[model samples]
Target chain A: MKFEIIDYKDTRSGFGEGLLELGAENPKVVALIADLTGSLKMDAFAKKYPDRFFQVGIAEANMMGMAAGLTIGGYIPFTGTFANFSTARVYDQIRQSIAYSRKNVKICASHAGITLGEDGATHQTLEDIGLMKLLPRMTVINPCDFNQTKQATKAIAKHKGPVYLRFGRPKVPNFCPPDCEFTIGKAIQMTEGKDVTIFATGHLVYPALEAARILEKEGIQAEVINIHTIKPLDADAVINSVKKTSCVVTAEEHSIYGGLGDSIAQLLSRELPTPIEYIAVNDVFGQSGKPDKLMKHYGLDAPHIAEAAKKAIQRKA
Target chain B: MPEISELQAIASQVRRDIIRMVHGAQSGHPGGSLGCADLMTALYFEIMDHDAKTFDPDAINRDLFILSNGHISPALYSSLARNEYFPVSELATFRKIHSRLQGHPATKEKLPGIRIATGSLGQGLSVSIGIAQAKKLNKDEKIVFCLMGDGELEEGQVWEAAMYAGANNVDNLVALVDYNKKQIDGSIDDVLPLGDLRKKFEAFGWSVTEMNGNDMHEVVSHLKQVKSQTHKGQAQIILMHTEMGMGVDFMMGTHHWHGVPPNDEQAEAALAQLEETLGDY
Candidate 1:
């Protein structure tokens, strides 16, 4: 399989672009920020649609509750904040007002995982996927690249219910096709192979693709599938891909617990038993460093995924 | 509008319902419920222009009320029922398994009058501000009223929401505090004193109004005045004063009944003090 690299861009740009488009297309789309407009790339949307944009001024708890209230008046409110503050600091507010109440709130979080860099462990959130997916009626999406994130931003607006849209701050290789359409709860098959399956999400998808290329040179055809939507896991896609491969390796820039890997392992353990390897953080806090160095140190780069894929293949029955 | 005497008769029945409901559940907050009975009665029966039969969660053009301190759900449930939001007999199922009335006010069961879930304190004010802003965005011109316990003011998020509403000029909102001066452990002064609430709210850019919440006529007239003050470039908050347990004799003036329900003989004695004008459910 061949693909073209479009450019190097942060996935948050995709969110900003998609939000800007929504501002023009849908009159009811409102944007709320807790003082991180420039970082989240919500500046353009806030400027273009000033009336619909609300700056809550560093109060995340109030922002979450206000977002829940905005839905009561039939408005689609997208709240922007850092991943840590978005989930951990305001968990009760989200639980009572947004998730349990079943408010049509889109909780768009930026600077997810250690890729946020330099900000250290306090700013990075590796437990966000687990925290969000645990709540009933919550749809969690962690898009891979600029193109996919943009499409996902537009997709969640059309799909009603509570959604946690996770993205990052670093500029990675934006290889996904610009025209690719995003569908909620559907997995995107990047490359198909027959020996082993490499399931990846968020910033780790490009590395998984690279890992597949490395495995191909060693006479191993590793399949790479993008599991963007974590909750409502695409069971058919996982089962079908694993049936041919018979072994699995899940990769993500999140903690090993309650991330994409756990979701897949739980699925396969119940449906079709298979040996699995998780390429994620081993339940530890991240440190301040360069994003690429952090990825390498945490064993989240391409070479690590390739090695994990081989280990998974070796363990298959 | 109902006459003052008529509203008082409804309040008397609402007080009786509060006692009966708490006694039946044996596990609800009755002190605050009994204290806010008159205010709740005034809001549902006369103050709010709400359609109880055709209750819409959106509440579009109607006045919306949120019980922020949801532990006192007995009062809200009785008021909603007395206003015909649901069958009055349903109040018997409070805090039971497979019942719509959870320990707290929740929207999950699709209860007609509840727009959002509350029990976790300090969240309702923010939600009410959000609704008020939405009404402004939609040009609906409807008022949003939120009732909070004085003890509920200790949560930091309340002030966060207070600052936001004041800064954003969320003028269509009317926030009221059940200033019973008592909390579960002890009085609010002993726990965490909210020094000079009127000055605090005034400092936060709210036009403050003080009223006796237990009096039916005062509650009705003050709420009406607050309603007329909406869309006037500042949010309004009424610091309503009342006893911890206002209606009942033995229960008044203490925080012990804040969550304790009356027993069999105690319920009979409490019922004897209050006249059941509208007939008990």
Candidate 2:
């Protein structure tokens, strides 16, 4: 199936829209922001539901704990902040108060990966997915576009437990269907092929579809699948796809160590061993640059994914 | 409400449980557990309005307590079991493998009373503030209480939560500090002085009060006064001054018994000092 771009939008706007919808639908839904309401596009939710919204004012740790506390009274709290502060900054707070205690919190993080641009390495978070996925009860999700992020945001409210919903800063192509069903831990196959499978997540998913197009020109029919959920990964989808394709290329806007690539590698090594090449940041910190430049610099664009797919296909015996 | 004498008897028995639970486990914090025994007993037996039988995590319309300094799980577990949240027999399983009584208070094992996991300090105040806000949102006029150690104030997150609660007027929270003046390494002043706790909490916009945590009557009355003061514009905090180990003479006056379990002889001596009022769980 061919995927088309619907528009261009920042994924955080999708989260804000979804949160506003949740405020209308579920009275139990509350939002907490650590002083990044504008950046996270949470202004609408904050403005609409003043009573339910809490402006935590640059205290990420307090925001996480408060989110957990809100859950005890049957309130579903959605905390907003940069991906870095959301994960690494208040890791212990999330670990003890949320994940270990099994609090139903939606940790909605914006400005993920080097795509955060201009703000440099400190604001950018390339390790959030790894940090959150390591926690016992955390459900990690990196949605591809605006629509998918909005859908994922609404979906996780119904999901009981801690969730890390990661989204990007730049105005990437909003290609995901607005009405498409977004089941957590379910993979969406964008295209079909028999030679190799290109698995991607977050901002890199659109590039994976582009990579499939690039590979198709070279007589390489690449199957592109969007693995939105990192933890509790869609193993059945992954196994079934690799069984047909035999070779795999995993792509993400994160470090190759603990991101989607590592998750896929662990799964394949245990269940179905296959030749795989990773298209991700190679264990290095990001720098200040444009989102497109960073994607190309870190070798995370379509051409790089296509090249990785070729390498994986060649390795298949 | 239980009489002040009855509360004192329960406190004495709770002290015994803290001592014996630590001795039975051979590994638990005894000093703080012993130090906060009266306050825990007073809250469970006389101060808070809670049901011991049906444990609900939401705790809607009921007073909730969070043990922030979770190292004193023995004290919390004993208070909980003695209050009939669980069978008093489970007190013996403190910190044992496959036991609901974890080394720190946790909701993981489905323990009846615990609503959250708290071992790492300075996080509980923020959690309590959150729950307090939730109660306000639900229009459930219940109060939320959080207990923290004096040394736990050193964590930056505590001050952060303090600032939020004070600024937001989370009026339904009563945070109690077990100001025993001792920690693992040494006295709180020697380790990391919490410099004028009342002034600091006041600066963060809290209404500060002080009480003798080891005095059962004082604990009961002071907590009752604090509860009455809730929803009157500011979050409440009680700087409860307590001895490191109140009943056990050898354990008192030092930080040595902060986390050390007593030997058989020491346990016998400690148990002999307090009468077994609640039948020695």
Q: What DockQ does every candidate get?
A: 0.85, 0.92
Task: For model 2, give the TM-score of chain B.
Answer: 0.98
* Candidate 1: regions farther than 4 A off: none
Please provide, for model 1 over B91-127, each residue's C-alpha lDDT reduced to its tens digit, 9 standing for 90 to 100: 9998988888998999857998988999999999999
Q: How far is B182's C-alpha from truth in model 2 (Å)?
A: 0.9
lDDT of 1 by residue, A1-317 (tens): 66567899999999999999999999999999999999999999999999899999999999999999999889999999999998999999999999989999999999999999999999999999999999999999999999999999999999889999999999999998898888999998999899999999999999999999999999999999999999889999999999999999999999999999999999999999999999999999999999999999999999999999999999987
What pairs collide in candidate 1? none
Query: What residue pairs are clashing in model 2?
Result: none
Backbone clashes for every candidate come to 0, 0
